[model samples]
Target: MTVALAISGLQKTYANGFRALKGIDLEVRQGDFFALLGPNGAGKSTVIRILCSLTAKTAGSVRIFGADIDRNFPLAKSFIGVAPQEFNASLFETPMQVVLNQAGYYGIRRPVAAARAEEDFARLGLWDKRNEQCRTLSGGMKRRLMIARALVHRPRILILDEPTAGLDVELRRLMWRFMTDINRRGTTLILTTHYLEEAESLCRSIAIIHRGELVVNTATRELLGRVDLETLVLELAAPLDQLPPSRFRLRRVDATTLEVDVRRETLLNAVFAELEQSAIRVIGMRNKTSRLESLFMGLVQGNEDSTRAAAAALSAAAGD
Candidate 1:
């Protein structure tokens, strides 16, 4: 497969001496829905900004469609579309006009821009509101408008930063379906969202970044399989002040429930055997598969643990 986006040794540092992005390398394959996961301030946005030319990278190289961003800015940028986290459309502009103007920025002719804008608005369920001022639209409508504007130019790569942030369940699902259709028709997508489940479902691969560094990048299935723990919540009919001594570890969540993190290999029978041995009645039981949320928390918190240790060492040295 062709490489749609590539970054090598990417680094970004602000004038305040805060390093926002450490040396990082990533590749987004053509026609793939690639999700980037990280906590706030994890440099996910930094990478997206650099790729979209919204911000300059302090160091490193980026190529879009094999065209170097720094060397061939126009060619590199032309193949990419960005729906930023912030809304930037003119409040007075109608939805149709907003998208049409975006197309014009890419040098698309007026007639073609108008036609494409109408088509996109209809497809995105914004056709009825085409002539309404952007400010008059609801939050979800505005978000859909942003997506329609991005699609105006028909870029090969779409970078959506928290695209479904405040959308309702139904609207969010609609957008997901639209995005999947776009991907199937050959658009490469790079998504950064707090909705980990959305990424887990939509992305073929994922890259997790933390504190300016790339921690893990692999296929979604592979990443999930690598994190071998699954959570089981057992609700007992009666309250238990303490847990029975058993081989399986358990954490009390409430008066009647206990949460257990069990390894996938031994989870099923071990849990049942332990419950049987203790004569604990399982009134209700729920199992949750390890997902991107757990995986991300593990990586981000794991990094924080190391950083805390290093800080403690530095503090001790200063005391001496």
Candidate 2:
């Protein structure tokens, strides 16, 4: 597989001596939709900033498509597009102008930049608002504007830090469709979001950082495979006073609802067979919790000290 981005022994220590990242090593394959997840102050932003050159690394090396970022700055940077968490675009500028301005920064001529701007604006559902001042747009619209601006350059790698933070459910799903389309077209995407469901749905692979350390890195499915048990809530056809006597671990959530812990090693069919033999008719069933969420919590827990330290390091760096 072609490696789009690679980092080795990456470390970042702030002026106050707080370490934000401790020897991080990661690789993102070309054309992969990857998620870089972590709790607040878990060095997610620090890693992004360092990659985009907004913040310099204290040590270690970074390579984009095999080119060292520090040594081949311009060449490496040209392959990257970063949409930071904050809305950094000029609020006074129109959506049309915002994208066109970003295109200019990439040295695209007016005619070419105008075409890309039109395409991106239309694609992002900002075509009608193209002429309107960004300040007049809603919070969600502003986020879309940043995405359009980032894509205007058509970079190979896109890094989005919380791209849909304040968006409503409808807008969030709309963005998800857009993200899927772009990734399918071969743009490598690195996404960081607090919304685990979004990451679970969009990314094929994930790397979670906790306490400024790389805690979990694997394919989404593989990491989920590490989940040992799933609680299935079954809806019964008739209200049962007691759960069916079965070898499976089971409990009654309510009169009609039964909770069964399905172990990874046990066949779900076996659980059903036990219920069937006991004469409990199951009308429907559903997961009691999200698999990805269960794994994420398990991996990131017990790192409160690192969390607080990472937070302080970020604050100190910002103040500096």
**Per-model TM against the reference:** 0.85, 0.87
lDDT at 230 for candidate 2? Answer: 76
What C-alpha lDDT does candidate 2 achieve relative to the native structure?
0.83
Give per-residue lDDT, candidate 2, residue 127.
90
Q: What lDDT tens digits, residue by residue, belong to model 2 across residues 1-320?
A: 99999999999998899999999999999999999987677898899899889888999999998889989988888888888877888889899898888888789898988898888888888899999998999888888888888888899998888877778888888888888899999999999976677777789988878767886677877656655567889999999997666788899989999998886798988888888888888999998864456545544575455545543433343342
Model 2 CA deviation exceeding 4 Å by range: 237-244, 252-256, 298-320
lDDT of 2 at 280: 85
Model 2: ten consecutive residues of lowest lDDT:
311-320
Model 1, 60-161: lDDT tens digits are 999999999999999998999988877889999999889878887899998998998888888889989999988899988888888888888899999998
